[model samples]
Target: MRYKGTKAGAIVVAAVTGSVVLAGCGDGSGSQVEGGGASPSASRSADAQEQGTTEVRAAYEKTAEAESARMTIKMNLAAAGKRITSDGEGVLDLATGDSVMTITAQDKTIEQRVVDQVLYQKVPGQNAPSGKPWIKIDLEKVAGQQGLSNQQIGDPAQTAAYAKAITDKDVTKVGTENVGGVSTTHYKVSVDVSKLPGGEQMSQQLGPTLPMQVWLDDEGRLRRQQIDLTVKAPASASAKPEGSASAQQLKMSTVMQFSDFGTEVNAEAPPADQVADMTDKALQGSRQQS
Candidate 1:
């Protein structure tokens, strides 16, 4: 089966949560759909791999028709001797990158609104000097600042790119499992992650291999997915986060759960006066620091 390269929306969670601008996730019972630690002892089969690829590809296509969905992302990782975790929930406008997502990390929770590449964030208790409750962030600016691609950071084609990453090999069906309580087929998958849409950045930092597992329903909708990756920390002027006390690698596990497909999500931005342009704020902040 061929995995079609379509425009898929993406919202990369780890970096969004880890930025010094703020900071920096779970698995299942319901979320078991996201961890890469499940080891399947079943024999490998070329036929299984091909079939799994077909199913995964179909799931991507099927979900694309879903105009909106309820999305949950849970991430856990270790970087620079510190462990980071976060949980994000919200509605996504599948056709566009527009979304209203709230991320909860430790004791802080921040809500973000997106209209295409323009992002507005509401960091609780922290407002701009102007006291605006919402700040607009230019994803393009953040991408360049962080050395990330729009897709890696999350673009409209994010899901499509993620689905396109699944190739037709090295896939093993682990049997049937319930994802989000729905009975589905479970498969453990590995890919040349460097080949994924935004995988080049991941490859640059972590090496080329990424392990993933997914649970797909008969309707070809992906109910749950998990990935695990570990990469060494490169000694660099910028890679080391400030205040880090230990030389450490970045270890991350991600689980994304999707449900309530076709749900109508009316996510809108706040009033203009309540919004502060973060693109200008970040640049201004940089200028001042310099």
Candidate 2:
């Protein structure tokens, strides 16, 4: 199996969701906003000044915090003339810089923990041996179950790295829009992904450049963001590389939706009593194997 299934698994677990604004520096002859002969950069600076960087940053922080709370994400994957729908709830731990997601479908349950740039999936009946640096989660086996490889989960440090990428760039007010019935300010930010520390890695994952339109509420929380992701996959890889005639080109448009703010429930710690049952199950399964 090609392992495209890993995408779905990772999406289910680590929906923990960037920042920055950049200015178009190519030409000084760009269209002016309200002021005469003003570049896009000038316009953005004016807006930020009107809002005050301190206030804007505060708003961004509040929104970021709110967004990190309880969220229900619905993922729909369409491929090979088949569509699969998965629903999951996630709690973002800003303190530990991690996200815990639990998703259940039919009789299968998957609990995923994304921490320190690694994604771990614990199946209902399988227990990994303790103290492993990282256990490779077989995404193929967990296609409809739950799992993620290190590469697919992404690095947490990259998140902060990307945030700093466009810190000095300008943010233009793109007007107001309503999301989930909440009025929000839309900002058009131009960020150079190649400038950040992990920019190369993110660019590889997203392919080339990434342009995003971010929406924020009056409180400065991110309501939604839309990025046009263009990924180039080889033809043979896109199809099924038989006899290696080079990879085919494949393109997909991904729209990631975020919603249900301020709904994060408190983290439910695992019960101490449950450990004995899990250990017994693991031992029993191991004996059966022997």
Candidate 3:
């Protein structure tokens, strides 16, 4: 039980701090600017392409400028023939980079809090040698080591950074749709992962291009976004050979929805006495358990 808890804690930190971000290709169903005869209809398609590029860029800017918001997230991950689903709701203070979230998975609930750019995760009290209920991680130090900017660490959805992946030629206006009871414009774009901020490491695992869908409300703010990706599971010596029929695949899907913009969010850190830092001593213990 101790080993399992420690390993799980390590996995959570790696998953969040790593550069393996959202990726995969979206189905683009819009005009082609290449190999076109100079027809009047083709000219209109070019104009529409320009319009899509503008709209997506505008949405990115608007979302970045938001003060705060209430958000819900759903994530499904499948690997090694096992599937797990998790749901979370949170309030984010964009201005202060503070937030609180509660996530539930497999009948277990975990609470996460971020205040002043530091992250705290509630864990089983027995897992901590000091009997603390919360594990503290210095997000600023970790983000710096990972070469992530302050904005990247604060933006849980990475919505702004993801929008930077799409090029003008890759965006296609898919039409209008209702999201969360609000009318929104749907757009599909194949993300060039190489263009994403801090994307150098992720592009290798997720491939160079991936698909993403975004919905923008009337004010050009991001109402919802989704990413789906399937990647080959890393092979082990005892497991089936790579690319063989028995090889495994990992499929991950994530969706984030935003509402109640400019809401006040309070995300205070746990008291010092009840917090244990994820330091060298804890890491050494985890290594031994593995």
| Error in Å for residue 118 of model 1 | 3.4
The predictions' CA RMSDs to the true structure, in order, are: 10.1, 10.2, 6.7
> How well does candidate 2 score on lDDT at residue 132?
26
Which rank order by lDDT, best down to worst? 3, 1, 2
The sequence of per-residue lDDT tens digits that candidate 3 reaches over residues 1-290 is: 44334333333333322221232111122232222223244778877766666566556446546767887877777655557777878987655556788877666787878677666777443446667887776665543433344434444355445545655666778999998999999888676767776566546445777767778899877788776766443232224555576554546676778899887798898889888887444444333422
Residues 109-146 of candidate 1 have per-residue lDDT tens digits of: 87877775677777688777678887676667644543
lDDT (CA) for every model shown?
0.56, 0.42, 0.60
Question: Where does model 1 exceed 4 Å of error?
Answer: 1-44, 156-165, 197-202, 229-250, 279-290
* Model 2 C-alpha lDDT per residue in residues 76-100, reported as the tens digit of each score: 5443333445666676643333566
Candidate 3 residue-wise lDDT at 30: 26
* Candidate 3 vs. true structure, TM-score: 0.70
TM-score versus the correct structure, for each prediction: 0.69, 0.52, 0.70
Best by TM-score: 3
CA displacement after TM-score superposition, residue 164 of candidate 2 (Å):
4.2
